[model samples]
Target: MTPGSGLEQHPLLPWLALQHTRGIGPVRAAKLLEQLGPRWFLSPRLPDCGLSEAQLVQLLTPSWSVLEPLLEWQRQGPARHILSWDHPAYPELLKTLSGAPLLLFVEGDPDALSLPQLAVVGTRHPSYVGKENTRNLVTQLVDVGAAITSGLAIGVDGLGHQAALERGGVTLAVLGSGLEQCYPKRHRRLAGDIVDGGGALISECYPWEAPQAHHFPRRNRIISGLSLGVLVVEAAERSGSLITARFALEQGREVFAIPGAWQNPQAGGCNRLIQQGAKLVCEVNDILEELVAFSTAALKIHPPATEELLPYPDLLDNVGLETTAVDLIASRCQQPVQEVVTRLVELELAGWVESVPGGYVRARRS
Candidate 1:
């Protein structure tokens, strides 16, 4: 996974060389790549660098000791490869964002990071209601075949992962900490579950980097950047969830907000997003319709299985009928209510029926 090994060029090598240099940050590294390339650290270039005369002294300074750990790291293996902006594997969506991570030290499946993604984000300290809302909506979205992405922090993020797993879908966990350490210690098991279930655990931080305060806002940007849109399930006025919404706005990705009861303090930020014109999400269809319209493709959804249903009729013939209750349908079909409920769920997912207040309504066929 050494970046650009199979390609004709490695633009990031020059950038990473500077990244390994002390006193050079993203702005400086980008400047160096534009000027002397990675050689900026080795050779001396004054005019090519935008650095003022005073800045040149600092820029020219050497810090080989700072690179000792990195050199040793490079010798280890493909299990870790540092990715810079120019790596072919670097996501195209990520390239459009400002200050994409200078290096991505990835674990699990790196390919999953490049998929067309929709980020599901919300409050880390979610209320009970918030968790349920996240689970239901995420399940619906996954059912329609959109991959779930989130910063695998606690609360709503963890719930989204669980729901996607239950729905037999893929999810990506963007970490605020390093690959080696799982934050919230409680989610160590859940993190394993995510990787075991065909998703990935991702981070840009180097090994053993702890979840510091500064890391999360930076992490928030990646959560938004990797997504076609971001769903904010719930958030307080000043919560970190707002950071992701802000990044989504700045990154030009769609920002979706789920409205909740005004009586709940946790709903404040999402309510504000709605007033400010973020989509007011009520169901997964609301999201899928918008997504399919934007992406200009039909959702890759598979129909539910027969055994998972109640052995009802060819549901198409049952279309355009009056609404019917689960209990009544069970009696009509001579099946248990649970079986009837399952069939109705399958039909509803297939878009042949819509769940009404007290019953299921058949969709009118054209």
Candidate 2:
């Protein structure tokens, strides 16, 4: 059924209750629903469904107070919606997963979930090249009629959404917190833009639930699950983006990674994924060719641009993957400390190097 259709009957309550019910997580809930069907809440067989007595009691007499905020939030606007497992608007791609969310709180076009999506995820501190790659790929993906999906994070995630919006393409932001409590506090505006741009902001958390550390890993699954595939723009050896890529693999969704230079730490995760059998993507067609159904038309392929020479080669050579002190770099280059600092700033702006806590490190190679 469509959202807001059965609000008075509170059809979503049972799903929400099942969600908050202790000991019955998404996997168990999905299995139970699979076995007993949507009307299982009223069945006499609930006692035989493997739930403990206390769990059964909690399900039978769900705390209405706990669910009021979500219900109220949905009522506040026509755009806001709550999708139960049985809802027609629940994304079909996500439903195939074993541990799919019981309920989805959506704040935008629910139909956007049904569109072909490619998830773009990466580090929070992306290199300038990483940002450029994300924007360039997203722009072309938009041209191919694919929706961009990502966590509403600061670096790559935010850039993906912004790029899609700038291209006037649909994008979805899966959140680690409730719809009301936009995490990072910085992307709240971007979240609004997603909704305003005919995209969506989605979350499985309760309306007022704060973002906890554990919430993000679970959030990653939704990002991957909702998409046809996931693209790792730039990630470290250990990153949440890798978790999303892992989920994409388990979900049977195609996984794509952009190869990065060996010396770039941010590119380490992508390189690792390529080694592990993820399709190495160099352009939009690499993805479109795999998800053939999403390709709308042939793209005008362009030749690769000539790589520019690295400015201040001597100064850059002094910087390494590990943070190198400015003084050490100056001594190595035999330049004054002030001159070294000025050139370093130019290098940083050029995306050749970045300043870190200890000093400077090489940024991603283009």
Candidate 3:
């Protein structure tokens, strides 16, 4: 739903009441949402808690009792709306996660929240390879129409934001802290670029909430929940990146990990994830191929390859990935080197090939 549609005429109001009932958390909210449809949620007709006696008490007491603050927030108009549990804008990806947020306090660009997103996360201190891979991947992902989502941390996350901006693409930064104070303090510039590029900044907590260590793990769930998949560029064995990856698995979103050198400490978590069945992404195609089944953005934003590069002589298709020199290409087409070189230049301009150290490498555009 759009911003103003949060609880207006929806059955979500009573569910929000159940959430505000002082100790009732997500697990409890799920049971009650199904039980109380659009009517009064506190009705005595509800049955006994399926949870154990101890769990029952936990369910009855609203763990999230900030209903008044939340409602007051909604009263402020749609500028800062809260996406309730049943709203349509609530990501379909998030619906799969257990203990999903009963409501999400939204900030800027609510419309984009409905767009397909790919979470890009990694260590605060990424290695050279990690940074390069992230930049390239983010550019390609955005060009293919997937909005980049990251924490805007110093390393890989920062690179993702920068790449998206450089390519004139959109991005979303999920903050561990409130939007009032963009964390890392240093990334204030990068955050500006994101917003300027039509990206948004979001968090599960309220606007005044401050960043804390504990808030990060919970923030990971939102990162995973917003995207069709979580892409880990680089992460240490116990890094926050892994936490987001774990949440992706739990949320039933695909988990894609970029492989880094074994000698690098940051690659450990991603490599381990690959061992546990996460898709290993060496390049953007690996990511695109995996996401194609779920999204058609790749088919739309990605430009077609040039005629010279067509694998089967079809200008609409990519000249297959092959190993051939400019000389071979010229000879095969029966054209002069200068003529062939000009043709290749045009193809390169259209994102079909790249000049390598000794020859050209087939490149794909998104």
TM-score of each: 0.70, 0.77, 0.69
Candidate models: Cα lDDT each: 0.73, 0.89, 0.73
Candidate 1 residue pairs in clash (backbone atoms < 3 Å): none
> What lDDT, from 0 to 1, does candidate 2 have?
0.89
lDDT of 2 by residue, 1-366 (tens): 333544535776678678778999899998898889879898888889888988987887644665677767989989999898889999988998999998899999999998888899999999989999999999999887889999999899999999999999999999999999998798889999999999999998887889989999999999999998999999999988999999999988999999999999999999999999999998877887787644333232333456688799888888999999999999999999999999999889989998899899999872
TM-score of 2: 0.77
Please give, for residues 1-366, the per-residue lDDT of candidate 1 as tens digits. Answer: 332335223344344444555566765565555566434545656455565555555444433443445545545645455566667777778876656777776655667777767888888788888888898888778767777899888888888988998899888888888867787789888888888787777777765688887888888898888888999999888878888989899989888999988989989999999899899998876676566645635356443334533334643344336777777777766777786778788877876688898787876531
| Model 3 lDDT tens row, 258-329 | 887899999999999999999999888877767667576533444334435343242223233655677777
Give candidate 1 misplaced runs (Cα > 4 Å): 1-13, 20-24, 27-47, 52-81, 297-366
Q: Indicate the residue-level lDDT of 95 in model 2.
A: 92
